[model samples]
Target: MTKSLQKSQSSPSLHPTRRFYWDTESLGVVGLFTALSKVVSLMVALLGGGMNPFTLFLKNGIATALLVVLVARVRKFGTLALYVLVGQIVSFLIAGGGMSMLLPSFLVAALASDALIAACGGYRRIGAVLAGVALYDLLGRAISLGYSFLHARENMAMVMVAGVFIVLGYLGCLVIGLPCGAKFVKELRHAGIIREV
Candidate 1:
């Protein structure tokens, strides 16, 4: 091969280490979030309605926001998407596969989150984080609702009620999760856990 071609192939851009740090950080953060989600799942199971649409919204929103902060700290694109897709799979397995049907929705949410973050120019901006969280929740919930409606196991009225609750949850994420995430990020920066961009 020509020297120029060889040099280009061996460049840092082609090196795995170029992403090793951010990849490891993303994995660690995803693992932590997945574990926490499982615990929340357990609580939901034990408490019956605790994981209802409204509560699930609050739970997932907070988790997503925190994840956004961590991903932003790494300053890497696609980290949030990687976290959501992989994290959902792992979490699904750990939960005994009961929610396997929602995998596609999770993947969609991840892709949307990635696009939203990229559009906002990265996670360092609160707008990016908020948009990612909102899109994830909206798209994921919409898919879940559509699945339920198509299956028709539940009555239309019940499904509509659930949909309303889900919408409420999305709003909760925007109202509560947004400011809380901003504060959390600020705290992390102050504690040196998150470096300022």
Candidate 2:
């Protein structure tokens, strides 16, 4: 009798049309991070560093950290990367910056950040991811500076200014992102939601 009962319980039916709130929570987190990244990016753009000393350091750093959060909190890195890239392409087109200046710079930042984050082990431990992200921003900005020096303007001062801004960008990431990422990871782990994704 005990064996039969155990068999029955083990074979209990699962609901065919059931739903859960897990995805809802995941998407909410994803949206929050993505929105924050966009706002930070807008601020960076307003600073107008693409052609000057800014070199979009803040923009890339924030964006990288945000993307890391999204990957850790919600979707896979590839999924969020594609979405970010699509959004960037559309936004750039609408803004109508000169393709010669915008296309390579945008591609460099997007691809580098994505690749770096992908290199980070696993989906959690956002600090490693953030470091990768910071590196991406730094590398892309360096590449852009090189491009400008070689083809666009050729000024040593411009390179120095861009370098400084890139450093500031990394510092900004360290300030605004490190705490939030650690907090989220803890929460997710406590909730047993880390394995859900």
Best by lDDT: 1
**Candidate 2, after superposition: displacement of residue 64 in Å?**
4.4
Lowest lDDT sum, 10 consecutive residues, model 1, at 42-51
Q: Rate the local accuracy (lDDT) of all candidates.
A: 0.69, 0.59
Q: Give the TM-score of each candidate.
A: 0.73, 0.54
Task: Write candidate 2's Cα lDDT for 1-197 as tens digits.
Answer: 99987776666374444565445666566556656766677777877745343435446545765665566666454444444555556556655544335455656665666666667664455655666555555665566556556653657787676557666766555665455556666786688866653
User: Candidate 2 clashing pairs?
Assistant: 49-55
**In model 2, which runs have C-alpha deviations exceeding 4 angstroms?**
1-35, 43-64, 99-120, 125-128, 147-154, 187-195
Task: Give the Å error, residue 8, model 2.
Answer: 39
CA lDDT of 34 in candidate 2? 58
